[model samples]
Target: MFQDNLTDLLENVQNGALSITDAVSRLKTLPFEDLGYAKVDHHRSIRNGFPEVIYCEGKTTDQIRGIFLVLMRSENNILATRASSENFAGVRQIAPNAVYYQQARCIVVNPVKKNQDANHYIAVVTAGTSDIPVAEEAAVTAETFGNHVERIYDVGVAGLHRLLAQLDRLRKADVVIVVAGMEGALASVVGGLVEHPVLAVPTSVGYGASLHGIAALLTMLNSCASGISVVNIDNGFGAAYSASLIIKEIMNGCQE
Candidate 1:
């Protein structure tokens, strides 16, 4: 909607159909819209390069639908994380185009399609097959935000050769998101191998001693590798967000 309004304003100016003051007046409300329960920030895409994303876990179905409607009015794409099938049903009532990713637990409305450069991509690596859910969340989030993503799964430190075999593939990524639960050693190993940024995500995929991923979280936080950064336990979305921002900056630099 923002882009459409800007285009209309420019066309109006060219045709002398509207004054500059009128265009400015129309744009003032483009920043935000208040809906009592929520104040949707329409200008977030302008300011942050990405629109606000809905966290559907705590919100009621009605609340999610309402928020999704307001955000869909914008030109930017809409993403709702941690959304259940029921939440998707509510959103689909208003947006028939919306799709639910069961494994990723995410709902995407009017997903943005970009011709991504192969050289500029995010690599999502997992320590075990059990970690793929969390890894998929990270991969989906990064891809939704217009970044090319490559998956390198089940390459834990148990068999160093598996990870070692993918050294060339891992190195090709501009940013690497390492997802693990047991001991969280994969992040450090990837960090040590790559020259690019490493964003580690710990999942609650371990056994009794793992303490619901706390042990892995602590392990990642204390990683000795130089450029290793960690997010909260099971926070694949957060890891992807940080990686997207890093990739965006790199893209901007290349364009300049």
Candidate 2:
């Protein structure tokens, strides 16, 4: 439940079709719910245009389940990033429909259907096969938020021909997410070729000098290409969120 639901609820109140007590029962979960350890923000959908997402990294399984149940009250799409199989089990006990993407380490419950009228799509490109996990994180996150995502994998700078082969498809995207490790040169290469915004994600998939992706992060930060934005090391979710925001703004602008 979001903007439209709120509007409909108010209309029902005004029309006297629903009793005040009954409406109150449905509205109890409006602002948020406090569960000792966490306060689930159900109203985030109204404010951010999307519901609050669960990050199941350090939290206990029970905590994740509690939050998941609270968010489910809103009946909106729910995303849990950095989730493990154990985390999925906790959520699944409550929401049997929850689907988990192992490569992404993310879970989606009640995913919203994409808007078929969307005018543009986002491209998720990875430098190597090893970087596919990070790329999947970005791809799945974008899809969860109801954006069209095109994935191009194993196109590192080591083989510039591979990247060039996908240039035409990359050029058509409204937003491009380049996921890479090692030197992280793929972001710069893709950024130079695309006219749209390019969000870079540096994964922790490299050798000694890579410094657990710090080297790749620095390389992306120092990229020479224009229209390029870099997120944290191994932060696929950040890249997806940034790309989603850019795509949303572009779509909103097109509608106007």
Best by TM-score: 1
Model 1 residue 96 CA deviation (Å) reads 1.2
- Local accuracy of candidate 1 as per-residue lDDT tens digits, 73-109: 7655588899999999999999999989898899999
As a whole number from 0 to 100, the lDDT of residue 76 in candidate 1 is 51
What are the runs in model 1 whose C-alpha is more than 4 Å off? Answer: 1-31
The collision pairs in model 2 are none
- The top-ranked prediction according to lDDT is 1
Q: What TM-score does each of the candidates earn? A: 0.88, 0.87
lDDT of 2 by residue, 141-187 (tens): 99998898899999999999999999888999999999999999999
lDDT of model 1 at position 83: 93
Q: What CA RMSD would you report for each candidate?
A: 4.1, 5.1
